[model samples]
Target: MLFTDLARSLPATIPFVGPEALERRMGVKFRARLGANESVFGPSPMVLEAMAEAARESWAYGDPEQYELKRAIADHHGIGMENIAIGEGIDGLLGHLVHLAAVPGDRVVTSYGAYPTFNYHVAGHGARLDFVPYRADDHEDPEALAARARDVRPKLLYFANPDNPTGSVHDAATIGRLIDAVPEETILVLDEAYSDLAPDGSLPPISLMRPNLLRFRTFSKAYGMAGVRVAYVVGEPAAIAQFDKVRNHFGVSRMAQAGALAALADQDHLRATIIRIAHAREELAAIARRANMTPLPSATNFVAIDCGGNGDYARTLLAAVLKRGVFIRMPGVEPLDRMIRVSVGTPDDLALFEDALMGAIAEVGRPTAT
Candidate 1:
């Protein structure tokens, strides 16, 4: 048996290591798990109840069209049902978009340190990725990205507002300008996975007026439905229709649709969760300050702490936290990689982080060769 040439050439590493894998390796459960931007606050009571109710019907396959979820999303966003497409999550939708736009050797443009999942999709589709370095003063510079897209003439341009790793965001006006600057034929894939966690006015208004813009939102973050694997894309009807050609129809489970629908309906829970996340972010920043680290202002559920040194120092701090049974992550690229990213969690979790971080610094501060 033989694998495809693409699969053979691709690296064998999984882009992200789940917490379960870390537990397996360490042979202990994490004391304060906050690496993945999951909502520790958990999904709404209504969402859980809906899932439980749907579970009884698990023997049947999910609606291949995902009609109910799509319709609900469309109503919420004030868009037509045809303008929506649901999938296993934004990850799956991204893969389908990459395949639809980029043939092998086609170019794809993205920020150098943007979401890795989008880059992974580009690689999987054999697209050549042209990366623009993030703006030195701003991590989420849509203008810089627009310049890169214009220069590269990529078939797909990826942007993640309230970016991962850095937790930075671009204002709606800036995003609009970037959209305007893109070539008419270029596909702009905006991953708004963190948009729900972002403050009001942070995201662009829900409008499918652009032929090239595709916006993806997920239940994985603020909704606390990462395990549910439900996400949806909003775009022009014609643009969204392309997804039907490549998506795994029954990929989204019935439980996912039911749960997500219930989650959407429960605005109160979502509001409360967002409030808690905001406070946690502030608390984490305060902790970073006490530890002599700088916490970058974040609009997402995670805070990126400037370790005040190079990547090596950040890595040391991260390892120290992990050893202390606190799971966290950092940027994988240079410069940005100097900051350790910690997701917002419950007060108890933040307390654990503060203790672990202080201990780690103290341990690493021991006298050594100067």
Candidate 2:
């Protein structure tokens, strides 16, 4: 077998160990799938119908340009079709962007405990990564990160508003400052996967664009189309055009395009899901409090509950919780690893989490005071 020097140098393992994989390993199916930040509420009725309709036409390839879906997304964001580029998901787009931007030994910057998938892409592309720690309050520090960018001038710098692992967020003004802080040479990859579920005015206006700024949006989160696999990046035409150079031409399927179009067309359904998520987030926080854990303030659909100890204690608790058949997740790094990340789900799903949490605590006991 032959592989590139890069491929041979890298670890054979992948980052994700999904619930199905866990079930196979542990020999028990999870009762609640809350780890992956998927919307248990599911997609809108219209989106389902559109996907079903499109599935019947599966013999034909989807438009390579993703013309109509791109048009709908453009109209939704008040941007031109030229400004958007569609891909399999944010994950796919991240991989392509890394490919476009990085050479061997290029540097990429991101928050220490931010999205692992982005870091994975950067590493896979043979780029060195520089991580800035989250702020004292658990938010990604734009100022510190910008300073790092100014110093390092990495090929790419990533910032996710309503950041993952913590569900912390910054207002539009802060985001604008982040955009401005990027050095001319670096591409700021702004991930807005949770924007639809964020506080009103938390996101900068969609009119915002820059030559070195690429903002990613997805139908996976608020649209509940994770399985459908449609996401897009918005940037100046020149930057967005880079995807066309290397992207899988027909990666976004007909069903995905149709479902995303229907999802966007039904804003009411999206709004209702946001509300449901907000309510569930509160319930998750309350569950943490009842269990004597500290729930971080969240602007996203998921809540991060501080387990009141070090990473080891949190790991033990997470394992006990998993053994209870509740599928949840935690950061793999220190500091942030002390918090277990729980995605918003239906009441019943959260109730299962609550039971799992309480039982896990009973089984594992509280973390020893440090």
Q: Write down the lDDT of every candidate, Cα atoms only.
A: 0.88, 0.93
Index of the highest-lDDT prediction: 2
Q: Please provide, for model 2 over 1-370, each residue's C-alpha lDDT reduced to its tens digit, 9 standing for 90 to 100.
A: 5999998998866677989999999988899999999999899999999999999999999999999999999999889999999999999999999999999899999999899899899989999999999988999999999999999999999999979989988999999999998999999999999988888779998888889999999999989999889999999999989899999999999999999999999999998999999999999999999999999999887999999999999999999999999999999897799999999999999999999999999999999999
Q: List model 1 lDDT by residue over 1-370, tens digit each.
A: 4988888889876778888898899776798989998899999999999999999998999899888888889889888998899999899999899989988899998888888888888899899998888888648667777877778788998888878878888788778888899988898888899998776777879873699999999999999999899999899989989999989988999899899999999989999999999999999999999987899999999999988888788888888888898999888988798888999999999999999999999887622322
Error of 1 at 215 (Å): 0.3
Candidate 1, which ten residues in sequence have the lowest lDDT sum? Answer: 361-370
In candidate 1, how many Å is residue 359 off?
Answer: 1.1
Clashing pairs in 2: none
